[model samples]
Target: MSRYTRYGGGDPLAPPVDLAEALDAIGQEVMAGYSPERAMQEFLRRGGRDQAGLDDLARRVAEKRRELLARNNLDGTLQEVRELLDTAVLEERKQLARDVTMDDGDRAFREMQLEGLPPSTAAAVSELASYDWTSQEARAAYEQIKDLLGREVLDQRFAGMKQALENATDEDRAAVNEMLRDLNELLEKHRLGDDTEQEFRDFMDKHGDFFPEDPQTIEELMDALAARSAAAQRMMNSMSAEQRAELMQLSQQAFGSPELMQQLSRMDDNLRALRPGEDWSGSEEFGGDEGLGLGDGTGALQDLADLDALAEQLSQSYGGARMDDVDLDRLARQLGDDAAVDARTLAELERALRESGYLKRGSDGELRLSPRAMRELGKALLRDVATRLTSRQGQRDVRQSGAAGERSGATRQWAFGDTEPWDVPRTIGNAVRRTAGEGGVSGRVRIHVDDIEVQETEARTQAAVALLVDTSFSMAMDGRWVPMKRTALALHSLIRSRFRGDDLQLISFGRAARTMEIEELTALDARWDKGTNLHHALLLANRHFRKHPNAQPVLLVVTDGEPTSHLEPHGEVYFEYPPHPLTIAYAVRELDNAGRLGAQVTFFRLGEDPGLARFVDSMAKRVDGRVVAPELDDLGAAVVGSYLGSRAPSGQADYRDWFGGRGFWAG
Candidate 1:
């Protein structure tokens, strides 16, 4: 085996970063009111790793190809041959004139030769090689031309060969030949499926310096070589017919041997047969200023091709496609290790969302939030409420009042008709202490009715909450759609999770009003209708109050518009703009009925519509309700605060009195 010396220092490899952090960031954005699509785009944009670098590589490749085509007219080696010939001819004339011993016949012959030369480049090159020369400079220049031609042709097949073969040596040629022979043999064995992993290892152990990519498997090595081979073919395809012929002729002079050309041709054929999927016929137009030869230009084109593939894979926007479909290895090659990490993290996040039951497919074959997701979203909203309450009240437990539900801090002696659960730990401690003082003989301890202790629990009043959310087209157009849904989900979650005794009904009013389950409401898309039927919504709230006559009725109305529609007899909807008098009367009549039923009404007014403000204020006054105009960010907290306040003791003047007349509820 020939010893090979590799050149150039490459970049140092860095440790891979975790992708989970990126996924978490995306999820947090989604929870904070951004759609999943928008959140993913934002995360990628700010996440530091992008396709910008790949785009730069693509541009460089195009520039290099253009540079090669622009200078295609003049071959570097042929130019050198002409200049050396001129110098050699001039030096010969100088020596003949200085020596006075030269005959006239000799001088005449040389002058004729110099003056009358072949016009064709190939003929001139042949004549010059056979000419006799007296000057050593002329001979050395001629030799250098041959070496340059050989190296240039080899450079067309291999990148970085020009630098490596600058001063040609017999040993370097031998080493190259050996490496090519071994490579071809390995590829041939691979094609036949007769090569083992150890065989590949042994081959690389002997000639590894030639392949700097350090491929670990035969498949990897084949892929790398196949890409380069395809690029070389593409470079030829991009050239004009005349340029192609000239390049092929020049390639024959590579390494000053026909054997080298034969070996490369065999390697190319083997690669094509083994990896036929490569883009062998693809070509790119070059219009850049940087000069690059055919080999370097082809390498750049390959990089650009890889980058285009990476861009498509990283987009993650195809039909029926998910993050898991992204190709991480290809991403790492085109962008960097960080991009691969980010992609993997996104895939994991999507899988987590699907597998953990946070997201599920609906009957329409679209991804929607599952019931579990609604509960989680609700919990998240409740946590936010707790945090906001803590910030204002300096930290206090937000507890729900229930009658005989759980053990309380205070205890009383067991009484008849008392259904409160006993504080087992405290009851046992009391019994033990009493028995210790009595000094009872030890077989078993006796418990009398007088010794039993029971926990004292407060009786909590059950409230029936009907949440009326305006889902008109205006809410979505004005960006209040998400906030409204969030408010409803939070309130629903609060009632169901904290106040088990409360009956919560969700009623959405657009052109009409209807009741929806919690899951249906959470997965509901924005409406595109124009009417806000507050009257219909109010009518539904009154009916709900009628159904649960014993429970305290609390109507929470969230809307961004005044009553533009109402329901008529026979289940027909009447929609109008500019405050219809009949619609106002219908809405007021329903509110009065709710008020007559002793329902607590709270109107959450969204947006800055003056007409809506005036109407909501009038309605609140009519029904003895409160009107709250909170900021979009504070809507959830405001609604939850009102709900908690409604559940306060009946003697409290209003919901505002429960919060000490501070915070969002005071408004």
Candidate 2:
């Protein structure tokens, strides 16, 4: 046997939404200085590779609305009334011409009355109400006009009433009148807060056939009635003044009596009082030759209302907006189930991102990328960098593992901060022995905390790394701010995940320098300050190196300008442009200090300025380090490669081999 599930609620066969893609896109925007919430919203607005975005949905909604307005006009009922009146008059003239047995005076009088009837269809119908029609066909046609008018008026408020009341008898009309009276009474009681569930149920029991919507409560019933009533009013508003006037006059002649009109008017008033939120005064412009009857016109207006609501939902621009706020059922009704599916998928994507704990609110009550989110984003960046590195230089032996050195023929109990490879066989054996000695009977051997073991290895030296990035206005102006942040994140991920023993410090400098966490640095906005301040950045790097005196010191500097600022002895930043001699001297002096501490320096040149190139070359030569000139796309790969090369225990020889004379080094 087979069972079926709804197609678009969510298809089990469909591939899962890619949250990594969303986080990666959002992280890039955040790195470019967007807040986390805005970045997420941007990603959702732009959608993913296989889905439609909010903007596309909104465009479709607007087009649908335009199509509705261009396909309809509101003169159908009036046209029908005029046609009936003309036919009745023609039939009456034929009957008079054929009545040779009647007196000449009487025949002539009837002919004159027919010829001198009022021009307006409503007026003519009213004038002929008392005239004794000579033809049976003419009399029936005249009566049909009253029935049609009555049904059309009711249909405008109660959908399908026009078709249901066709050729109805007096008993049917009387039953409809009774239903209307009961409905009005119920609405009045509801307005006064005196209606009960049983009373509503009793009304539904008597008139359930009239309302196909099967509203379960008084409020639901009122909402249904008010919405339709408002649509009917809007249809009237969209008509010309003459059309509205004719409709008003003709409505009084419905059912050949004024009682139906009186009851309908009372019901409309009660509906307005109960559902005051309905847009009863709104109107729309419809330009088309095809006419819509009262019922169809009201439906078109309701469609317009739905389309307007859809437009607002798809905008997602209101305060505290969420994708869940979109009504999927209404969207399906207007745009089809495919659109609802698209909207539902977007909502699920947003909910998943929020519930996955990747984005978290900080102490300041603003959304920020959590550490887990940073790790995922960084991993994605690192993978891209690795792909670029492989394509450019061919595959190299750059496998990253926790254990750093060659393993010794010895095992030790595991502890915190251990990076050695796990001894799985020995650990399992210890678990089995410990469990058996503790009198534990089990089908599967259980591993306890005290039974875990790790393979011993020779000690490998760890590196103290400092990455200083330029954050002056020029970096942002040159379209390098995001790439700089990406490079930092990729390097940080590599160090944290692969080289667990290494110490990493991130420092950013514009007019001054300060140490920053990776998250803070990634989200730092660019400052339009007028300084490079490499001297201050280097001072911070050297201090970090001093803190880890026993580890290899590696400094990576990314900048596009010469030194234009320096920190004075009083800790105040002094800035100057045009290569201030004192600033240059201060920067060079710090470079000497970094060299004295045996720090391996690498200057990643960002632009093709001849002066900057010359200065970076001179500086790299002064420290016996290297300089790399790479495009923005390769920034992450270049920084990661430099770090890997410098952190080798065999010193500059291993660093040179890591590049394999690939000409990555500019000097």
Q: Which candidate is the best by TM-score?
A: 2
Report per-prediction Cα RMSD to one decimal.
Answer: 8.7, 6.6
Any residue pairs clashing in model 1, and if so which? none
In candidate 1, what are the lDDT values of residues 1-667, reduced to their tens digit?
Answer: 9887632122236334344454455445654556544554556535535323223333433454455455443233444545765677677667666766778898778778766776644445456666786667766765665666566555555656767788969998898888889989999998889999999999889977767778999898898888888887887776657556655665565555778888889999999999999988887665544544555656666766766665555554567666666666666665566656556655655566557665567777665556666676676666666556445543243222234443324455666665667667767777776777799766556676667766644445778899999989898899887777778877887667556678998999999999998667655667798998998998888889899989999999999999899999878999989879999999999999999999988999998889999999999999889999999888888888777767755423232222222222322
Q: What stretches of model 2 exceed 4 Å from their correct place?
A: 1-21, 24-34, 390-459, 524-530, 566-576, 651-667
For candidate 2, the per-residue lDDT at 282 reads 92
Summarize candidate 2's per-residue lDDT along 130-209 as a digit string, tens digits: 99998999999999999999899999999999999999999999999999999989888888889889999999999999
**Highest lDDT scorer:** 2
Task: Assess candidate 1 and give its TM-score to the true structure.
Answer: 0.69
Candidate 1 Cα lDDT to native: 0.70
